[model samples]
Target: MTPLHLTATALASAVGAGSAATLDALRQERSSLAPCDFEEIAIGGQIGRVRGLEQVELPAGFGEYDCRNNRLAWLALQQDGFIEAVRGAIGRHGAGRIAVVLGTSTSGILSAETAYRARDPATGLLPDWFRYDGSYDLFSLSRFVADRLGVTGPAMTVSTACASSARACLDASHLIASGVVDAAVVGGADSLCGLTLRGFDSLDLISPERCRPFDAARRGISIGEAAGFALLEREPLREGGVALLGIGASTDGYHMSSPQPDGIGAEQAMRRALASATLDAADIHHVNLHGTGTRANDLMEARAVNRLFGSDVPCASTKGWTGHCMGSSGIVEALIASLCIENDLLPACHGLETRDPEIALDLERHNRTARIDRVMSNSFGFGGVNVSLVIGRPAR
Candidate 1:
């Protein structure tokens, strides 16, 4: 795959908005994971819920598309003058030539969940004002963003579990390289709701406390909500920006929720990403593990990295800070890795108090300085969907 420049970026997660806030949290080892208070649910586990989404007011004419998910997206776009940067891209490449691609496992199903509670008692029908297509559908997020951004080019959404947004980046690169579009808006948004919490709880995947990824005492995952956006182009539009050096995606046909116990599929994705970048495992300076604080995920990923990189590459799971943003985990972790390159800092595994002896991961124990030029972030999802992204500073 041709490398594409990440011209501009924005992020809104449990830590805060924009790259500066996120970087500060990482450097200070500050985590945003808190007890689950979302929607007043009695669900257990700490979540990286974004603060103040309820106060965000949508722009005029976008009210109909309003929901927690889209609201979070709007908040993210307002960060670091990201919308202005995107508008400039629109001016350079006509709206019709700029595509939009976003990823999300749960679009705005929260709105539907609310609507269901308000259904007509006699008719057993949802409210007349309820719009399922606008809020609940997977494609709704992309459509809403395209219209809001005034982009007339092809618009689509990716929903391959947790690997969704990272795959969106790959798809966007393909569109640009194929001349289907000159540039693309790529990101993802996932908001917390009752359904997801209950589902995960029923599956016994919800942790009762803050998640400790790669820790010997690790138990389960902590659900979170976040939205991030990146503008991608063939050339850099801004100085000192990051680029998508390589992308690798694979499916091992493994268990529904359990990874290939041996990590073969994860290994392939990382290897292919390095190959696409025209580099080797030795070239990568840092790694962002898909350490969801689950036993199976951490163990499998540890085996995969040990097999490929030999535990030489410094790595950690930022899920302790952001609590696994699920489908949006791809872009969020990518941005975190980009911060690592730009700042030359390796963040500590926030909540990992004790390393799991079984998983031979060279987890970062503290915030430290390093010469980081190339980094890989892994995003492996349920049902064997795996994606590895290689991000690096552009060659001189």
Candidate 2:
């Protein structure tokens, strides 16, 4: 796979509104989990809830796209001059030459929940203002963003659970390689809602406290909301940018929710990513793990890492700082890995208080300085959808 240059990136999560705040929280070794205050689903467990989405205003004509999910996407797009970068790309490559690919699991389903509650007593009709396609459609996020960004090229949505956005990046790279587009806006956005919260609770995957990814006492996941975006071009818009070197995707079909206990699927994904990148596992400097804080997930991922990279790879999970942003996590964590490459910093595994002796992973306990030239991020989703991405400093 020819590398795709990451020209620009931006994110908004519970840690703060922009990448600068995210970097600060990482530098301070902070965890952003807080008590569950999302809607009326009175459930136990902390969540990575992004603040101020209620205050964000959508574009005047794009009122139908009003929802927590799209608001977060808009907020993220406004950060770090990402919009300007996209505009510049548009100027260089005509609007028809850029593609828009986004991922989301719960795209404004909260709007549907709200409208369902407001149904008329006799007819059971939702509020007149509520349009299912406008807010609740699975493709609404991608459609709204492409319209707002004035991207007229190919546009698509991905909804492969937690691996959604990371897979979107892979899809974008293929589009560029196939000469279908010159550049792509790849990212994802998911917001807090009662549906996802109660659903996880029903699955018994919600933790009562902040999630500890690989701790011996680890229990379950802490749900979070976030939006992240990156602009990927076939060539570097400027020198010294991060590049997506490889992407590996596979499905284990083991269980609907639980990962393959032995991590065969996870192992295959990482190995395939290495093969796609045309590099050995020894070339990877750091890894951003899909450490969801669940016992089964952490164990399986650690086993996979051991089978491949051994104990030498510095590995950590940033979910403690942003929570598990569900589908959006893929893009969020990928951008964080890019930030690490740019700054040469390896963030500590935030929630691991006690190491799990069964796993041989070299968990990062604190921020460390390293001559990191290449990094990897793994996004393994429910229903056995797994993806691994290799990122590196642009080759000189």
Candidate 3:
């Protein structure tokens, strides 16, 4: 795989907006999780909801696209002067040469849920004001982002659940490598919606208290919402930025919403990623495990990493800080990887008071400084979809 430089990055989550805010929160070990209070949903699990979405308004002509999800995307684009950096990419590559590929599971279903609730009392028909195509459609995110950036190249939306956005980066890498586009905007945004909440609750995966990944007493996931993006080009627009060294994706036909018990698929993804980067297991400075605080998920990932890197590499999950950001988990953690490379900071596993004795991988015990130049970040989505990315500082 051809390495693509990450020109600029942005993040919006419950902690705050922009990559700087995320960095500050991680440095201070601040977590934004709180008791569930989203939209009158009676679920007891904690959630990481953005601070202010109701007050956020779309630019004039995009009112039809108004929804919590799109609003989150808009907020992310404004972060870290990311929109300006994208405009600069447009200037360099031309709008027609830059593609937009975003990932999300429930793009704007919140809007659809609202519309469904307001159906006519007798007719059972939705109101005329409802714009499913604009808000709820899966393509809304890519289209809105492309329109906002004035980019006219290929636009795609990936919906493979949690692995969505991380896979978006891999797809963008292909587009750039195949000459389909000169540059690509890759990431995802997911907002809190009743459908996601209720569905997960039905599956008995919602943790009542805050999530504690890799902890012996860890229960389950605390649902969260977030938006994160990165711009990828053949080379750095300027100099000295992180780049995607390699990406590997795989599928486990084993189950619909559960990972394979043995984690063979997860190990395969990491091995392939290392091979793709022309590196070895010893080169990975740290790992960002897909530790969702669930028993099955954490155990499977621990086995996979223990098999691949043994106890040499330190690992942790940021879900405890941001909660599980669903479709946005990939890019959120990818950005965290970039931060690790850029700042040499490895975060402690938040809420992890006791380590699981069954897990052999070295989970972070404290916030410490390390020579973190390359990171292997893993994202394992529901239904056995998994992606592993090797991100590091660009070569001199």
Candidate 4:
């Protein structure tokens, strides 16, 4: 796998609106989770809700894309000078050579949810202003991002549940390696809505308190919303920068929602990623785990990690800080790996208090400093989709 440098990255989640706020939260060991309050969702669990999507306004020409999801994307793009970096890439590669690949699970489905309530009584027709292509469609985010960034190259959205955005990065790497594009804007945005919250509640997977991934007392996930983006280039903007080294994707087809019990799928994904990166397990410094705090998920991932990296790998899950952002989980956590590499910090498994007796792994509990050169992020989603990414400092 040809390494693709992540020249610039940005994030907007419950932790805060940009990478700086996120960094501050990580530095100060803060979590922004609050009681589930959006749209009067009658759920008991806490949620990582971003504060200002209602005030977000799309540019005048892109008003058709006005929805919570796209608004989240707009807010994220304004952060960390990410837009400026994309423009700079366009300047060098030309608009036709840059691609926009984003991920989302319920792309503005809330718009449709709201529209259903306003339907004409007799005909059950939605509001005339509602446009599915610009708002509710799965491709809306990518289209909005590509049009906003003024890029004309290949643009698409990946929607493989939670693995969507990580897979987006992998797909973008393929585009660059195949000479299909010179650069790519890869990330995703997902906004909170009643559908997801209630959906999880129905599955009995919502945690009443803040999620504690890999904790002995862990109960379930805390639903969240976030948007994150990174500029992936053929080469680093400068020397000694974090770059994408390898990617592995697999599906076990074991269950519709639950992960495979033995973790064979997770282990295979991590092994394939290492093979693609041409490195051994010993070369990995840390692992950003996909510990969702659900009983089955955390245990299954633990089994997988132990089988591959052994119990010694310093692993952690940051979901307690931002809740589970669902589709955006891939990009938010993947970018967190880059943040760890850049800052040389290992984030705490935010709410980990006591280790689970059954899931034995070297789960990180407190903030620490270490010489981290390379790391991996695992994103395994529903219906057996799995993806693992390896990120490291660009080779000298």
**What tens-digit string does per-residue lDDT give for candidate 4 at 67-174?**
999999999999999889988998999999998999899999999999998999999899998999999999999999999999999999999998889889888988
lDDT of 2 by residue, 1-396 (tens): 888888888899999877788888988998889989888678989999887789999989999889899999999998999988999999999999999999999899999999999999999999998878778898899989899988899989899999999989989988998999999999999999988999999999999988999998888999999999999987897778899999998998899999999999999998999999999999999999999999999999999999999888999999988999999999999988988888888989998888999978888678997778888899988889999999998567
lDDT of every model, 2 decimals: 0.89, 0.91, 0.90, 0.90
Query: CA shift at 145, candidate 1, in angstroms?
Result: 1.2
Candidate 3, pairs of clashing residues:
none
Q: What residue pairs are clashing in model 1?
A: none
Q: Write the per-residue lDDT of candidate 3 for residues 1-396, one digit (tens) a residue.
A: 778888989889998898888988988999999999999999898999998877888888988788899999999988988889999999998999999999999999998899998999999999888888789899999999899888999999999899999999888888988899999999999999998999999989999899999899998999999999999988776766889998998998899998998999999999989988888899888999889999999999999998989986888898999999999999999998898778889878887889999988777756778878889989988878999999997557
The worst-scoring run of ten residues by lDDT in candidate 1 lies at: 359-368
lDDT by residue (1-396, candidate 1, tens digit) is 677898889989999889999998988888999999888899878988899899998899887788899999988888988888889999999999999999998899999999999999999999987888887788889998899888999999999888889989888888988899999999898888887788888888888989989999998899888899888988887678789999998897968888998999999999989988898899898999989998888999999999999977899899999998988999999999999999989888878888999988788668879979998999998779999999998776
How high a TM-score does candidate 2 get?
Answer: 0.98
Better of 1 and 2 by TM-score: 2
What residue runs in model 2 are displaced by over 4 Å at the alpha carbon?
none
